[model samples]
Target: MTSRNWLTTLAAAALFPMLAHAASEQQLPSEEGQLTVSTVADGLRNPWALAFLPGEQGMLVTERPGNLRVVNAEGKVGPPISGVPKVWAEGQGGLLDVVLSPDFKRDRTVYLSYAEEGEDGKAGTTVGRGQLSQDLARLENFNVIFRQAPKLSEGNHFGSRLVFDREGFLFIALGENNQRPTAQDLDKLQGKIVRILPDGQVPKDNPFFGKTDVRPEIWSFGHRNQQGAALNPWTGKLWTHEHGPRGGDEINIPEPGKNYGWPVATHGINYSMLPIPEAKGKHVDGMVDPHHVWEKSPGISGMAFYDNPRFKAWDHSLFIGALVPQELIRLQLDGDRIVHEERLLGELKARIRDVRVGPDGYVYVLTDAKDGALFKIGLSGG
Candidate 1:
């Protein structure tokens, strides 16, 4: 192993005693059957998100400290890829989500969301796209596609998760920058899910396209810090989740021009345990209710849907990573409703950051820590 990998291995071992041995594997019993948790790669510094590359190219991972690298199928982490944009890299900010273009095979395009520095010490979430070089070592021709307006100075609450709908429209989930009232603002991109064309152009049919007062890219509004997003294959709609203050994390199927309640209709109170200033009640007249709400916040982060045929018990399930509770949550789905909920990996006690269903039909997760690691879950004997 290289020197950096060796150091990371030692760090992971020190942080996670269960992974004391290099290449350790653990078998745990679950409702679906016996499952095996295997370490894929280690020594990632607060790893934020991951995306599986097409075919044999392995995976691309983004570290919160503003580094991006590739990890091979054999679990060897490569050097940091070049040409990453400058990031704010402050508390709860940095290089965030990464995804490939829908036509990656033909276009070689990669999309990234991050905290970017703006004028006079202010910063906000930004989205950009670049083409991957043939060797996968650099991002070529990168350019900013969108930048959140009226940047704030706070270092937290950059809600950034990128997804492409079935029709190939790019949807970006953003946060309110800890500015509570911005969630209700019509002119700013904060606290809203915005849809745009691949090249950063607003779609002519967008809800506010013809309106001069509102930001035309908005698809839906009134959200907190959304860290997870995915396209629901069954419904052809975008599903997203966000962090509430102390409780009340929620999931919503965002629709065009609709207003989902944030500060004005939250089940959660301030972090100080006081009621929110603007909230009138838990339910409001004109606001769209969450599809599902967790009364006790799980500190939810990344999310993915499982529709693979390899595991019958796991199919049609939604896997979400929880940070504060340190577990992977499996929500059994009956169409749009969550019928049952199962918690996985609480014994590990690691802050689960991002969850994704691999192309190989296994569930993969990133642990958020100074010495984080990549883990894969599969059938015990598979």
Candidate 2:
């Protein structure tokens, strides 16, 4: 038997507690019979987001210390490719997410989100695009597409995630810069999800378009620190989840021009454990309620919809990575309501930073650590 088959058998025999760590394999239930968790690569340093390249192009991974590299299917990690934009690299900052264009096979264009330095050392989230060099060694013709306005100091909440709509518009998620009131401010780009054409042009259909003294890219505002976002395969709508203060993390499907209640109304208290002075309970007159809310913070980060047929039972489920609680969460959804929740990978005991479903129908995850790793999960036991 191959090594993987051996481990799968050993895990079935309850022998994985020793042989399957770091390069670990764990077993679980599946409607198909059994699930297998396999480690694809390890020894990464603070790995963040993952983007799979076109056929035979391997996968690109961003390490938070500002390095981007490609890892092949055989688990060989290449040297860091050059031309990544400079990043703040402090607190929650660094090279954040890497996503390819919808037409990436033809364009070779990739989008990146990171914390950028502003005047006087203050920092904020920024987004940019670059074409991968033919040799796959550099990001050529790179340019900033969007930068959060009125850059603020301190490095806690950069709330950066990127997604594309059916119209091929880019949706950028940002944080409040830990400045609570900015989320309610129409003038600041902080604490808002903005939509822009891939080339950095403002869409005329934007809600704030033609409005005086407001950033035209704002799609929805009043978010706290959204770190995870994905386009729903079933509905074609954008879904987002964010971190809350002491608790109250939320999952929302923000409508165009809608206001999602954040600091102004929350189930969470201040980090100091005191009631937020501005909070008005969970409901407000005009603001929209979260489609789903987590009364106890999951410290949720990256998320993706699992519609691929490799795991037929997982179709329509949402998989999310958690930080503080450290687990992979699977939510079974019935429309917008969460009907069931399953927590997996608890045996690994690592903080999951990002999760994605590979084109090959495997679920991939990136662990958050000084010595991080990348994982690929599959199903077994036919």
Q: Give each model's clash number.
A: 0, 1
TM-score for each model: 0.93, 0.92
Can you write out model 2's per-residue Cα lDDT over 252-371, one digit (the tens) per residue?
898888999878888899989999888998899899988888899989999999876445677689999999888889999888779999888777789999999876666889999999
State residue 322's C-alpha deviation in candidate 2, in Å. Answer: 1.0
lDDT digits (tens) for residues 1-382 of candidate 1: 4566456545533433332222668887787778788898999999999998876678899999999999876788899999999999998889999999999999999999999988778789999999989899999999999999989847989999999988999999999999988999999988999999999999999999989889999999999999999999899889999999989999999989999999899989998999999898779999999999999999999999987654567879999999999999999999998999999988788999999987566788999999999998877633
TM-score of 1: 0.93
Native-referenced Cα lDDT, model 1 = 0.89
**Each model's lDDT:** 0.89, 0.86
Candidate 2, residue 369: the lDDT equals 99
Task: Tell me, by TM-score, which candidate is best.
Answer: 1
